[model samples]
Target: MNGTDLLALLPEGWRRVPLKATCNFFVSNVDKHSFDDELPVRLCNYTDVYKNDRVSPDMELMAATATPQEIERFHLEVGDVVITKDSESWNDIAVPAYVEGTADDFVCGYHLAFIRPRKEVLDGRFLFRCLQSRPVALQLELEATGVTRYGLPKDSIGLAVLSLPPLPAQVRIANYLDGEIARIDGLIAEKERMLGLLEEKRAALISRVVTRGLDPNAPLKPSDQDWLGEVPAHWEVQPIKYLAVVGNGSTPSVENASYWSDDGYPWLNSSVVNEPLVIKASRFVTETALKECHLPKIQPPAVLVGITGQGRTRALSSLLGIEATINQHLAFIKPHCDALHPGYLCHWLGHAYAFLRSDSDGAGSTKGAITCEQLANMRIPVPPTGEQLEICAHIRKSLDVAEPLQSEIQNSLNLLMERRAALITAAVTGQIPLEELQP
Candidate 1:
């Protein structure tokens, strides 16, 4: 059904009101240049509205200076609602945050709009919840315009309508939501913490098994490498180059349509390195393009490492589950199977991510990358082939146990977010009365 049909379903004593009729809207005048860190005032930026339900003194707002005139024109007050006016996605546009507590020095920053509700017509908290509710949010998303960075134009937002209940009922609904959402958020946080612990445990298991071997009581010797510390006495410390044939791949020109095919050779990028085993690629290349692009076919069981990109991606390593070619940002290592197990090498590289990233040469470059020479020269702890297989098996078994628990927690978190959204929709739409929520 359309918005008009949804509005017709409002409860008794409720009426559809244009946002401009209920609130005074003001777009922020302060730009990046207006910010002065030395000033004592705080700026309520876009992130403050997008990520939070309320803007308060406790939030880490950016410090800036506004002239007395600017401050007088834009200073925030208690009960004011801040909304994101622009974002890269329409779903993020019109995100609202209620202003709470004494925020005398706070001014709206660029890309935000301040909404002050008329006391007799609207409650600030209620209005914030209404904007967040599914009906209004969907309307805002539909009205938002832009190709890359979506924006909720001031006029468009002002023209949007909300189904407003009497002030008392509005307050009650907002209060009920405040309590319920906080409880849901707490549960999500707990689940997220559990997931973090599980990840840490998984990483520790991989690091320990790969470096120290499965037999804890085995003899130890100094490896002389700072990252490896000590390995089993039987293990050898050798450069990766000596253990594998390291090479990179290429990308076919996208401008040439002939280079693309519906079903062709899988062309992997650095991103696929995040998966434990990359069995398929997001894109494919025609045989002609592969030959012209000089893309080498990476054999299965070979370790693929992301030598370029941002964050942990620069150090990510995974085993190729199929014969595929990679982009220049990825390096494939064909380990000498007779001496080193591919699984063992992949796990060791995964464990050494931090060390490898630190030793990489592109410290100051925008695209952080590890040179092929640097990767080949990097030292790794190598156990005997039999022992390497044992370690790999043990690591896999540990992950098999831990990963499911992590998945369960993640699923719970996703459900909590969905429940939160549904609760807001139900409350604001008058489908679930505040009285029904009361203990």
Candidate 2:
């Protein structure tokens, strides 16, 4: 918001403060040696910062290292802000969150920085919202400096400013957002629950129907594979190579930026097709670019994965959106024969995804991988073609019911977020008078 817009809403005596003056900027200086079996330091990284403005709810990971000077310098207090000091993309940068660590005196790493504010100047939550606003995010990007990739520089932070209203108005904005955002969160939480159940039901449908067929009375035999436990007597396990023609894709010339375009053929990345359903309109491709690249023509509705990337998303089982080429980081799969159900295979492959990651990342490699041989050798528990169709039908129907219910929940969550934003807009702009919330 501009100075005039803030003035239109604020009471007399209110002043806009340069962010540096409004908050105490503490530089992060994490040493790479303070890690050990320790009683003291609580490690924090960018991954710990969630969109929810919360620290990582789970404690599975820890910090790299810390120094005594670094530790004390990085101490966090309630109402203080923590944010990613730098990011590859401004959009990827997390919104500021008040200190949310579980530790009594938590320490932040180099990847993040802290902003300790004078309690009288601004409401911590409202300032956090200010940071989350699109205008602010764009500002961060436009002003940020780096060689090739833009990054927020510590020196540039103080120079950035806000159209802050009076302290009382700031509290009102924070209170409004807090009171209303909770309702939105409830909606989001419900949507998440629906999504979880849909996924579970989908998996159960796949595992059950694929292994046992539609007829329960169908005699079953033991599948000796320990991971698979058992399956129907009629069914057999086969390698992926027998079912589909698989290959890797390439980036024609990322070095030649002109090869990439917003308008043209849909160049499919594994990410574009990461849904159960076949997606259309991939990230974008060109005929020239396609001819130049060795990307195989992927048929619609093939299962896919990222052969690389450190995130769980890379390990996900996704269906293709279009007939397009894939990158090296992706491995594609398609089923063969009429009896082999594509949907059934998709559901099954999705089930095996995590197991595959664990298997590779465990002993085979410190880093996760799905080698060409490993992919070919990968086992598929196959039933008769008719039975495979039946399983696919069952899964599609269950997900058909579940997906829309989840969509509605997601829509509700969206509204809640909109409402939260609206509330902030209103209070900060004084569209809703502050007296409404005051005792």
Candidate 3:
């Protein structure tokens, strides 16, 4: 009812009603397990609903088992809407995706619900746009309940109130929105592609300077590796172990009360490696945990590489700018700075990212994981200390030139997204008149 008060201000032809008045909703319980006693079916899962605006038969769906009863009760039709009913964050509840087509074996999966329109009172496409509006989203966000994970009770969803115009007006609004949204989405995709190309150009610049040095005309020699191809003739190719100490760290036991503290020793995880330089920790561990868990204290001026991750974090390198310990997934490379500068070593490791990932797979370690022993034996080209410093300075200067352009593109992307959200809210709430769309 709190969300419905705003509907009192609606235009003369529109009226407010609880969502259940126009649609029949069901919370699904079909799990992903493939039981031998059940029928095989393709499930319209949580991600399928959350990441998409419409679901069709052509999209890839997970194959699972469901009871005949589940298939009958939860089967999706072209006019039905599926929404995420539960999530780790409250704000993410009730993300709706309209059913665009139907397959006999398709059913709603766990953590989502099915909403079928009564057809006479509600238009499915118009209802979907209303759910996407901020007013409906606010009601769902407030009703979601949980400590670690949030869920919407059936009653809470059934009682959600929204204002609706006549079926004719709903159709017109949906049609206008369809054309405008597609145009905005096209522009957004084009700008995102441009942002990616700019990032690629910046990376290529760093790779060229670090590999070829400041003097492009310098003499070259074969490095005997396909990835390296050739290097400056004066540079020496050496194993990392010969020029630095490679080691790893472990996590303190989280189950023990004494292991954590409000103010304690800094501890880091593999995520910090996403930053070019790490100067802080995400959490803190007690000194007792440090001693009991045998976590090693890594000093500053070391480079950290994410050795294992389920994502692109693996093989990504960062400089350690603060004295802190790390989890086992990160390998700390403390260079013998009289020979290998940490900044130079960090840049070179970043350039070697592709090779590191491939080498890890070839070493027979767990897929996408790298061990400290393998990293210690990895080879790199070593330039003179003075040249390494000069290269680092040149890389910094190049980044300073590129940063402003990247920021400008990112700001443009943000504006486009904000515009998309505003347009949806205006059309669904009757703030934008249908007469204005006559063209």
Candidate 4:
């Protein structure tokens, strides 16, 4: 059903009220450029509302300066709700956070709106919950508009409608949601921890089998490579360049529309490295673009590594299940099958991911880059062709079992998040009776 139809379902004693009728909406007067860290005031930024339910003085807020007039106008008080005024996605617009308590100098920052609800008519916490409910969120999403960044105009927000139950019922529903959501969040956190442990176990298994070989009784010798303390005596150590052809791809000029195609050669970027075996690209480029850009088509069964990007993407490694061209931010390595198994090389690179990223050199900022030269010189423990295949088989078999367990845990986490959202929506809309939850 449509949002208007959903709003019509408000129960008895619950009236649909324009938000402005019961709340005072104010936009921040201070711009980001005006912020001064030396000043003692705390600024409640967009993330404060988008990521949290309540703002507190103890939280790490951005420090800034505000003029006396601005502070007087935008200062946060208990029972005030802060909301995101703009975001990259429509679903994130108008997300709200209730102000429980804040430092004496706390003021709302730009790209946000401060909402002060009339205490006798509305509960700020309940209003915050209501704004996040499915019906209201759907309405907000439908109303938000922008070419690049979605936004909710102050007037539009003021005109938005919400189902307002009696103040006592509002309080009861909010209290009931607080306990139930907290319980669901706890389960999500535990599942997340389990996923982390599973990933760690998988990494350790890959590292051990790839470097040491599957045989526990294999004799060891000093490899003399700093990263490789020792390896099986029969194994050989070689720079990755000796065993593979390593290179990066290029992007054609985006200004030239002729360079792109609806269906052409698959063009890959560093982000595709996140997939276990990349077989498709988000966008394709024309043959003209490929030739003009000098993009190299990496053959299938090659290992792909992200050479640029923040966080873990720089260290991400994957195997290519199809022939594709990559952007400059990715390095493709085609291993010589006679010397090294592609799967074995991919797993070894995965094992050395952290070290490879840490040891890389670039113009500046080690956080998100690795040069082609640095990647070529990276060392690997190489076994005989037969041994390499054996090791790859062992690692793949272990992952065959562990991967499904990880997927199961991840599915559980996803369900918990959906359950949390559904529960909040149900409670705030009065679908769940408050009387059933009270002690």
Question: Evaluated with TM-score, which candidate comes out highest?
Answer: 2
Which candidate leads in lDDT? 3
| TM value for model 4 | 0.71
lDDT of 1 at 246: 90
User: On residues 1-439, what C-alpha lDDT tens digit does candidate 3 reach at each position?
Assistant: 5646766678778988899999999999998789999999899999899889999777999999998999999889998989899975588899999999998899999999878988998899988888888888889889998633579998888788878899999888888888888899999988899999987887798788778899989999988778988999999888889999999988766568798887788888877888998988757888998899988888889999999843578899999999988888889999865788999999998899988888876634477799898789887888999999999999999889888988898899999989988998999888998898541
- TM-scores of the models, in the order given: 0.66, 0.79, 0.69, 0.71
What TM-score would you give candidate 1 relative to the actual structure? 0.66
Whole-model alpha-carbon lDDT for candidate 3? 0.87
lDDT of 1 at 21: 93
User: Model 1, stretches more than 4 Å misplaced?
Assistant: 12-170, 241-275, 280-299, 302-317, 322-340, 353-363, 366-377, 403-414, 437-439
What is candidate 4's lDDT per residue for 172-205, written digit by digit as tens?
8888888888888899989999999988998899
Prediction-by-prediction clash tally:
0, 6, 0, 0
Q: Order the numbered candidates by TM-score, best leading.
A: 2, 4, 3, 1
Clashes in model 2: which pairs? 265-285, 267-284, 267-285, 279-321, 307-329, 339-385
Instruction: Give lDDT for model 1.
Output: 0.82
Question: Of the pair 3 and 4, which is ahead by TM-score?
Answer: 4
Q: Candidate 1 on 42-62: residue-level lDDT in tens?
A: 888887777778888778878
Give the winner by TM-score: 2 or 3: 2
Whole-model lDDT values for every prediction: 0.82, 0.66, 0.87, 0.82
